[model samples]
Target: MSDFRDVVILLPGITGSVLANAAGKEVWAPSAGAAWRAITSFGSSITGLELAGDDADDGVSAPRLVADVTLVPGLVKIDGYSRIENYLVEHLGLERGANYFPFPYDWRRDNRVSARRLESQAMAWLKTWRERSGNAEARLVLIGHSMGGLVARYFIECLGGWQATRALLTLGTPHRGSLNAVGFLENGMKKGIGPFGLDLSPLLRSLTSVYQLLPIYPCIGTGAGELQRIAAAAEAGLLTHVDAARAHAARAFHQEIQDAQARNARDEAYARNGPTLVPVVGIEQPTVQSVQVKDGRIELLNSHDGSDFGGDGTVPRVSGTPIEMGDAKREVYAAEMHGALQNADGTLANLRGVLTRDRIDFRKFQRAEDAAMLTLDVDDVVLPGDPVAVRVRASEGNPRISVTLTLVATGEAFDEPLARDPEPGWQQGIFDLEPGIWRVTAHAEGATPVSDLVVVAAP
Candidate 1:
């Protein structure tokens, strides 16, 4: 009789895995020291990591998820994962390798490919765990952050993984896709990564996974503000690298999974046999809702879904839940960022709560369209010790809004009630820092709080 009966597998988003080459040379795994060196010549690295038609020539592959990605207690660490792996062991009381496993895959390939791989690996893993533990309660609980959730949903809905999966909790998964991805396609992948960003357009274009990230909704608008012909994206000047055929097929992949899920929902047998899917969506942070293409340039803009709800900085709140899973008995929202949701306090609490039946009430953290967004006009990298400009915004209707920055190192914090900005319906603040990592949270009256990570490094 094993204490922990479920096989809990954590699937990471794109870039969450460690990719290597044929000679076992790591092509992509941005640890602290490696990142500085990689940034300078990342262009050449992209060549090795690029996808190829022939598997024989495909040099890049993911060996494992970056399990060691963490921020140890002390020495002014950069913005790191919320320590999700530790949470499982300490808070959730689960042993690694016994039940908790991280499913890492080649994120550059199509999600369908990864989903199929999951179906096979998960089956074998589950069988082995069940036989060893001899526990009738043994099952599979999948926790997916970002794009990993898309892969999990595809497996459950389209590849028959639902037969064994008990629950799937998705953190900030973009069910309808993101405009940020559109921007990446318009430009290149690394152009968004950091300061010395390279335009790896050719390499990014070769990845089937990137094409599959195209927005499913009609988010593309013309310079003239015409939003017609949304799904026919290949014609969009911004998506020059992605051919029309690939664009259409990517949309079809999403549709196929959705259609399969609908059929399962309609089937009476599915109710008893299907897995429980819970989407932990983040809201009220800066997120890309739509894009306008002008003269071969893609510009991202944030807009509400007409319901007044916001989204994680990467995925719109409107696309948080798949249509099939929208009607879940409990609908919870958080104020975490897109990348950090896995280790977010609310997310971890919720996961623990779901397991022990003692989850925290996240209703207080709900973000309303009125005051649901906080924006920081800074990239991942900045001049060492530079003061970052922070912008906080709410719907024009918001009566008041405030900003708070908490030093992750010392837990020291300061709150600033922002003054109105020159732009209507916006407030601004300048955050002066002392070489460390900080977490910023925006609070508005009667609205859910919005929080994100900001790193201020020393020279």
Candidate 2:
């Protein structure tokens, strides 16, 4: 392996980490078998995974491992991060568990708890690697996907991790926050797949991180320009689950990071040599751009045209774009889904560039200017033994496009070319995919290929 002494530590987004109970039973993980079980009896199957109180920020939640579980209690999500792990090992010449491994933490609690844990572990690890490799130049290269990005930033900015970090690269992270989070907290987590669903509102409403994921942007208001603060939404009875105190604290968490960053910028030692912040944004997918309060509940609005606001299907561009992202050294846009971004080709390439400083032809990534904005018609979550109906419609009129399905577990391609649909600007195909996570890709002739993730739940 190449003697690249840089210590690489990856952080997974919310739900990207695995959690177990006091009985040592793995409760939170991605499995087709468990997925269906959780779907049907989710309220019962996943017991003891809930937190103690609604206000995690009220006091430091020091839940013991398997007891209170208020601390870091999980691993790098699931096998999905393997694609990323393998890429780093192969390209960066790093060894797993030696210089590269994911920071596993309980995803159900306060993000500050995770950030603090990351601080202690990352600093110690960096010191060890520096001395072992005899490379004083060695520093931390943190790669966070989704909410994991937020956790990493909190460590780097809020906790003084900038001193030892070489770079902090984020993929499809909702920097501001996601309207999807608001939808989840407002209506509770729903599978939307027939009756096989979970009313996780009770469990979800108590999460500080879930409330923190609410859109910091102008969301809860009329479709018009008039918008109110999230705290106002709570006061007006627009929110059912999230309370005013939790909503304000969640927003404050984001502000704390920005405030810390500003302080670091003013501090000479950090200002001169701060960690390079590069957030890789996902584009060209249907996403929740805004929400409206209808009656007593909040409703999410997805303008499925894949605009900048369309974001990466979950995080809109406005949210993913860090408020303090002032001319980052490296910035890229990939046409991929929120779930698939961690392993997307563009994301991998950008990571390579950030780690090794290899000259990348950024023109290749910016071709969306000439490329068609493709919207893959597929659900983010699917049912077991169900025929997934895949459709692709391009912004440019009837364009020649191809569709393909690839199993994420094996990296095997199962191509299902489409036939022209009766409706204009669309091509369609149907495939009976087994219970697992599958990547659905739609390629337009002479344009960038757009993709999304479809998880076939288990029985």
Candidate 3:
């Protein structure tokens, strides 16, 4: 009998892996000492140190940085992932280093390149599983979070990873793109009230992975208030004074993967005989839906003007759970924020729930229309005197969209005007309304109307 029946591999989100040097220098990974240094140093003076892996001069060019670094699976310790890895070993009764593995990678690199490393890891695990069981057909299970999910997808789709894997479960992966990455490139980090306030623009642009996270769809609008493709915006000179070479490189990488996705989706054999894919997405969290330049800097704004547009904070629900995976197994959760979904109770429960069953739901999903949906990306509850952020966004059509919020319980309604450029195209209004059910609607001249419901709960 085999000691290990099936292997479970865990992949971390962005910046979730730890990097250490022989001299005891640590970069990226969070620690008590790192936090103390951050509080004491100005800007990234203490925490902004770079490692060799972050260097893009390996002849990889602007967009696709060459993968010259090797990541050790055992040498990683990310806070959120460590907790979940422990749960798998202790609570799930999975043996560590035998049936369970945590895969850490250089998250700042291209995802497709990272997928090659994941392929190597999966093959080794599969070989071990087959040897232990005397069965050469055993496969592996992959649990990827954030960018890790993209890596897994690339392995399965483009690299024939489906042949060596059994199932894939992704959490908070941005299948489309994240606007926050664009914001980071444009505005950099807002100089917060602290000793560490510094311009993060230089650092954010240096990472090839951040450019990979740019929006793939036409959700972002240009200064002229027209929703255009990200590539189009870049070509039309929307983003200025940025790294053009890196952007081009990232764009080529994105196009390649998208073509791979389309090819896989069209393949009958891949769909019928491929590994099972389950996407668990979070909704009702306020995520950055759009970004623009304001006051000579980039401004990140929430979609639907901050309505619950359906995401876990960083990745929107629509982008996280891709339409391509509509027929695969799907799980939806509300109120789970980003960064902590790996260790969240609800996520764990869902993980167990999926494995306990042998069959997938195989639900068919349709691509949502541009104007068919609206979201009130706000909290469900608020205190009496708190300034509630009211934002509304549409799924499609024009960027010059208008919104009207009505406190249905009080029969009070008001139309909000669209905020000027550099701000998002949607309208945002802050009000201290009485606790009740509020209805928000978004409408453009040529698009259909959409609405979302929000509850202002008691404090």
Model 3, residue 236: distance off in Å is: 2.9
Poorly placed runs, candidate 2 (over 4 Å):
40-47, 54-79, 190-197, 223-225, 303-308, 326-330, 358-459
TM-score per prediction, in order, is 0.71, 0.70, 0.66
Mind giving the per-residue lDDT tens digits that candidate 2 earns over 271-307?
7888888889988888888667766756667742223
Clashing pairs in 1: 284-372, 308-369, 366-448
Ranking by lDDT: 2, 1, 3
Candidate number with the higher TM-score (2 or 3): 2
> Model 3, 70-172: lDDT tens per residue?
2222222333566677666765567766678788776767787678888887788778867766777667888998888888878887888876777889888
Candidate number that wins on TM-score, 1 or 2 = 1
Q: Compute the lDDT of residue 377 as modeled in candidate 2.
A: 88
**lDDT of candidate 2 vs native?**
0.75
Candidates sorted on TM-score, descending: 1, 2, 3
Q: Rate the local accuracy (lDDT) of all candidates.
A: 0.73, 0.75, 0.66
